[model samples]
Target: MAKITYIEHDGTRHEVEAENGLTVMEAAIRNMVPGIDADCGGACACATCHVYVDEAWLEKTGERASMEESMLDFASDVQDNSRLSCQIKVSDALDGLVVRLPEQQG
Candidate 1:
């Protein structure tokens, strides 16, 4: 299982163990971790699961696709490192991955 650390705006952090092959959004929602709403499930349709990946771990995660990039257009307070959690698939390489939640999600 991959260890996902989710950091909140106030610095409070929640770490959860997630299985491989599951999307980050799915893990967050299933584990009841605060931050990701995943309102559109795992369809990559809604930007509710928007998050900013840790700079050190960005390259460790998979590349973003054109559809995910386009959906980010609806995200609020988007940053250069912003990514939709639903687009991130969990894997052994991402065992210790960390994703910071935005103050406001779309």
Candidate 2:
């Protein structure tokens, strides 16, 4: 499992352990992390699960897919580090992934 940290816009933090095959979005939703609405339930069809991947962990999380990029265009406060959590798969390499939520989802 990987330990993922989800920090809300207000600085609230929720650290969760996610199984290898789960998406970061799944871990947040399963652990009840307040800022990740995950409205489309990991389908990459909405931007509610948008997050800013910690710069330190960006390489491990990998690049956003074309579909994810399209979806991110609909999110609020898009950034160079912005990503759709559902597009990031959990793995041993991402053991300490950290993501920050926006003030509000799109």
State candidate 1's TM-score: 0.96
Residue range with the least summed lDDT across 10 consecutive positions in model 1? 33-42
Best-matching candidate per TM-score: 2
Q: Against the true structure, what is every candidate's RMSD?
A: 0.8, 0.6
| lDDT of every predicted structure (CA atoms) | 0.91, 0.93
What are the per-residue Cα lDDT tens digits for candidate 2 across 1-106?
Answer: 9999889998988889999999999989899999889999899999999999999998888888899999999999999999999999999999988999999998
Give per-residue CA lDDT, model 1, range 1-106, as digits (tens): 8999999877889899999999999999988988788889979898999999999998988688999999999999998889999999999999999999998888
Stretches of model 2 off by over 4 angstroms after superposition: none
